[model samples]
Each structure stands twice: as C-alpha cells, then as structure tokens.
Target: MMYTVIDIETTGQGNKITEIAIFKFDGEKVIDEFTSLVNPETYIPEYITALTGIDNSMVAEAPTFREIASSILEITKDCVFVAHNVNFDYNIIRNEFKAIGLEFTRKKLCTIRLSRKLIPGHRSYSLGKLCAALNIPIEGRHRARGDAQATVTLFQRIIDTDNSEKVFAEFLRRTSKEATLPPHLPSDIFNGIPNAPGVYYFKNKKGKIIYIGKAKDLKKRVLGHFYDKTDKELNLCRETADIDYELSGSELIALLMEDAGIKQHYPEYNVASKRNPRAYGIFTYQDRMGINHLAYNILKNAPSPFITFFNITDCRTYLEKICVQFELCPKYCHLQEGVQQCSHYKIHTCRGVCINKESVKNYNLRVEQAISFTSEISSNKIIKKPGRHPDEEGFVLVKNGIYLGFGFVENTEQIINTEDLEHFLIRQKDNVDIQRILKRQLITS
Candidate 1:
C-alpha cells in the first residue's frame, strides 16, 4: 500500500501554509519526498516565526502555493494521506486548493487516532511527546519536514505491530472522503448558517418546506444532516434546495418554534415532527358512589381530558405517581380492582378511599389537588429562560393554560405583570406537541 505522510506550518492566525512536507512511501520505505517553504504572500506573525523559526526573509524567494500546488497533488495522488492530526493538515491543504479554484479531496489517516487504538497506553499523543516516549529521535521539532518524518516513523512502528492490519483497515474506513453537499443544494448555504440556537427550515426547489427542525447550534445540526447516512436524513439532504432560519435567542423558544413550524408547514419529509397518532389520554369521572376516579382512557368519550398523554403506559405511570404522592386509593383511580380493599390499602399506601374507610370528602380533596396540579400548568403565566444576550431574558406566555407564544424581555421587571409582558411576546399557534412539551416542562420545572 502507498501512503504519503504530510505536515505543514502555517502563518498562525489566518492559517496560510508557510511550509509543507510530504513523504511518499510504498509500505516498506520512503520512495519519494517533497519539502519547501512557501511564500504565503501574506505577513507571517512574529510569534509564528518564533515557533517555526521560518521568518519572512526565508520564504521571500520561495515558490508560492499556487506554483507548487500541482507538484504536491501529483506526488500525493492515489496515496492514502497520513499525518498526526490528519484533519488539520488535510483541510489546510484542501482549502488551499479550493482558494485556487480547484477542488481537492484525498483519503487520509491520522496517526494520533491509530496510536490510541493500537498502542493504547500512551500518556500523550502529541508528536514530540509520543516520539520521545517511543524513543524516536526527531530533529528540528516545529518544521514541516521534521514533523512529517516523525509521523512517518510513528506510522511504520504502528504498522509493524500484531494489530497493524486491523488498525490500518480501521483508519482506511474512517478516512474515507467526507460527506459532501447534495447535488440540489449549493455549498454556499452553509456559509450563511449561524452557530446560535434557532429553528431551521429546509426547502425544496419550489420554495416549499421539506423539513423543519430546531437546534441548540443551528449550523452544527444542519451540517449533521449532510453527513448522516440514514434514509430520512439522506432524503432531506437530497430534496433540500435552500435553507432558512430564525434565531430564537433560547432553546425553549427554538423548540416551541420547531413544533409550531412543523404543524404549520406539514413538511413532507418530516415524519417525526408530524402530529402524534396516539390518542392516549388521562381523564377524570365521578362514579355512581359519588367517589371521583382518575382513569386511563383511549380517546375516551370524556368532554375533555385532565391532560393528554402519548400512550396508556405513560398515562398509567403518571396517574400512579400522582396517586402515590397524594395518598389516593388505587381502586378509586382504577389502577387496582377487587371487591375488598385494594392492595395499596393493605399496605397503608392507599388512604382507604376504595373501602370507604376514609371519608369521601377528604379523599376527593386530594384527588382535586392532583387534578389542579396538572390543570393549573396550562394557566396563564410567564415562563422565563436565558436570552440571547446576558442582559436579556426570554419568556413563554401561557394564558389560562393556552400557549400565547414567546418573546424576549430586556427589563426583567417587565415580566412582573402580564400587561407589560404582552408588549414583548410574539404569539405562537397552539399545537398538541407544543402543549405536551410545555406540560412536561412545567411538570419537571
């Protein structure tokens, strides 16, 4: 197998390559080599010169990257590029090619990753540190050729071990060409994406939303779609033509917007964001005995639910927890069935409402408390969260338990009254998902 071990020294801040080295090997030995100081055509920082000792005068008459670019490509062609921290070196080279209006891509292997997997017990993977530990002498530490030679030696040592073949195979698999933009989407779309929390809309050629999503970091999440191999992810990448976003200033607002946007647009590719199919709900009823009972009903014919749940298991789990907390009867809640007192009553966990040992008024009082606990969460109030800026605060407004939407308030005192908060809030439509998310948040908070 052929491998080209490579390394580069840059101008430090903007990362223009000032020097680069490549050693082409054919498994057993170095077959070819290239090393040069390149005229970055830009000023090299004083600190970079101190670290690399390659100053302005040294590279003044050296060939520019454009002059040597073709030679670098030709030597490394069809060779698996190997380096310590391959991503840093590879991206630097690829981007240099890109600036010259040429696209360059190559398979790469990182010795740092290989050493961790194969050697396993190294205290450090830094080139100088590792070479010192391995007793591999390296001269001219920061220069490109010296570092590239050290990496080549390290690669040889790793390839001689018993796990060499497996390790190399793993490297080959990981270093495959990275995921790229889909044919329908231009690369410039990513240039405009911000790293802030927001909701992103993926649209097709006709300007229709194909998917809607929210992320704590918008750029990272959208880029993740490009790299993901899942069928749904691939479909989103393939169908997307343009990307749009709204900064929510906070994750809660982003989530709220995501929920409403999905429902509003009903995007074709967003299956997970579509309305829930489960009709499971938690409800209340009064039996003939004038005892109130909480029950799990599947689309149960009640006028309204105490609160909707996604499934019977969730509904039952919630009811059980509420009953346990309030010391209500398992039988009264329909969690247990029997002619005599329920099991919870025997254990003293139940307040004997099932057997009428506890007065109807007292037991029903706790039931009312549990019902009110959930019902009141839907009540009007300002839900505060961290804002985009340190001096600002974000809030979600829920009036009488119906979500009014969200907004940012700069003056925290403005949130003390609903009338003032209304001036800030941007209204959002009410959807079951939004309601459910808010319900969960209120319960947890």
Candidate 2:
C-alpha cells in the first residue's frame, strides 16, 4: 500500500493545523516527502511554540493550508494516510478541506494503535516518548516535517520488528476494507463510528434504518454482534446492515435514546416493549361498603388513574399478596366466588368484614390502606434523580419532605418548572416490574 506518513502541528485544543507534512512511501520504504507551514488565522498559543518551536514569525511567510491543500492531496491521493493519532490529524485535514467545499475521504492508520498491537510491551507510546525509548532521533520534535520523518522511521522499525504476516493479519482485520461486517451492514460503515458511549442506528445503503441499539462501549457492542461467543449475537449481527449512533452525555441518555430510537427505527432484533403495548393494569375500586378490592381493569379506562402493569400473573399476584398482607377480604376484592362471606372469613383471615362481623369503619380503614398502595391519589410534586457525571445533574422532589418519584432533568431551568419534574418521569407500565424496581430504589435510596 502507498503510505503517507503524516504529522501536523496544530493550534492547541482547537486542533487547527498550522503546519503539515507527509513522507510518501512505497510498501515499507519512504520514497518522497512534502511539508508546509500554514498561516493559521488564530494566534499560536505560547505553549505550542515552546513545544514545536514554530513561532508566529516563522509561519508569517509560509503558504497557508488553502495554498498547499491541493498539492498535498495530489501527492497523498493513493496512499494510506498514517499518523500517531490518525483521527486528530485526519479530522483536521478533512475539516480544512470541508471548509473549502471539498470532501476528503482517505484510508487512515494510527501508529499508536498499530504500536500497541505490534509492540506488545511499552511503558509509553507518545511520539517523543517512543522516540526516546526506541533510539530514534527527533530533529524538530513537534514540528510537522520533523515529526512526520521520525514517524516514518518508526513505522519502518515496527515493520522490521514484527513479522509481515502477523502485522498484515491484524492490519487486515483493523482496516475497514479487510474485515467482514455484520451481514446487514454496508462495507466499512463501522469506520465512521466513534468508540464513545451512545445510541447507534443501522441503515442500508439506501439509508433505510434496519436496527437501533445502545452501548456503554459503542464500538465493542456494535462489533459484538459479529462475535462467535454466542450464536444469538452472531445471528443478530448478521442481519444488521448498517450502524449509526448518537453520543450521549452518559449511559442514562444512551438508554433514553435507545428506548426512543428502537420505536422510531423499529428494528427487527428488538423484542420487548413494542411502541407501548397496552398492559392490562390491575386496579382497585371502593365498593358499596367501602371495601378495597383487586380486579383486572383497563388502565386508561379507570374512573380515576390506577397503577399500570405488564406482568399478567404478577398483576393479579401482586394485588393478591397486598390484599393478604393487609387483611383485605378476597371476596370484597372480587378475587373469590360470591359475596356470601369470603374464604378468608371462613378461615378467620378476613377480620369478619365480609360477614359484617367486623365494624365497617375498621374494615374501611384497612381497605383504604390497601387501595392507596396502588392508586395515585395525589400529584403534588414530582422529583427527578440526577445522573452520575460531573456536569451531570439530578433532582429530588419533596413537598414537606414527602418523597415523590425520582425523575431526571437536563439543566437548572428545566428543574424550576413543575412540568420538568412531571415530564421527565419515565412512563413505564405501572407493572410489577416498575413497582418492584422503584420500590427497591426508593426504599434503598
């Protein structure tokens, strides 16, 4: 492969390249070189000068990136552009070209990643650090031309040290060209993706979305579908045509995006919760004598709102357990046959309420307590919980220290309005899953 071993001296964190250089190579040997100093529109930070010795005066007479970009691209046209941190240099070049209305796409390679692979043991791998450790001389250290030349030599040494077969094997796997993607993807799509925490989308060449997924480790999870570890993942990966993603501030946002994304994209791999299925929520209502009872009821059709549910068995199971725990009559709760004194009454477990052996007032109190367990009788305030990042924010809603549900908000202003508090609350089917998770979290927190 034609290799353009390149380097750039940039403007600090802004990363705008002030100087660029490329040592063109045929196979493993350097054949030619190109280097230039660009007149950046911004002031060169002092630290950058101390590091690279390229002061403003030195670059005053040099041709700018716009002046040399065409020639630079011409020289490196057929080459695999190689650098220490390929992304930094490549993105800078691409951005510069893009600013001039040119689209620059190239095959890229990172010496840092390559060294980490080829040279298994190294305390540090910074260009300067590695040069010192490996005995490569640095003429200009941080200057683009000097750094590019040094990197070329370093690449040569790396090639000689590692067997060509071994290097090629891993190289082949690493490059977008050589590796097989998930069966559903277009070639090399995973190339454009970043290894950040985010939600991802899969699309075909036609740009039709096929799937959506989220990951704490985006690259690995997207790559995992192709793994041989589990047949399931392999099969799932096979059907994935293209992958796309959004970087979330944290895993929480990734999950939120994932939840909304799957619904939007409607990926076939997704199995659970298809666009909010109407859960047959279990509900409770006060009858003639004011006894609380459990029954299958339309969650949205209730006279008053009731707890939502997903687990059909647990819907009934949960309410029955609550009734039993609170000594509510199964008959009054509509869980037993006929109102002629429940089985609980015969077994002395009903407190004689069903048979009127117990006062209506006493039974009514217990009934109220049990119904209150599942009903949303009040809506005074909603509190959202914060995320786990540094700039990350969470909230707790308390009216007279009465804890409402913990919710999440983006910023301070969002938390000011009660709408933010209520809106951010994740609307889960008031199923046993939600009750269980929330109960445990709220109690523990």
Q: Write the per-residue lDDT of candidate 2 for residues 108-219, one digit (tens) a residue.
A: 7667656755675776667888888889998987788888888888888776774755755555565443233442343457777777677888665456776677887788
Q: What is the TM-score of each candidate against the true structure?
A: 0.53, 0.46
Provide the clashing-pair count of each candidate structure: 3, 15
What overall lDDT, based on C-alpha atoms, would model 2 receive against the true structure? 0.65
Per-residue C-alpha lDDT of model 1 across residues 1-445, encoded as one tens digit per residue: 8999999999876678999999998878999999999999999999999999999999999999999999998999999888886666777788789889988878877777677667768666678989999999888899999999988899999888887897677547743322244434544676688999999999986889989999999988888887674546655665677899998888888999888888788898877744554766677788888888887777755446878765566667677778887888888787877656677533347867776678898988999999997777657667888887778888899997789999887855544578888988888888777776775665446
Model 2 TM-score on a 0 to 1 scale: 0.46
Candidate 2: misplaced stretches above 4 Å?
172-445
State the C-alpha lDDT per candidate.
0.80, 0.65
For candidate 1, the per-residue lDDT at 154 reads 91
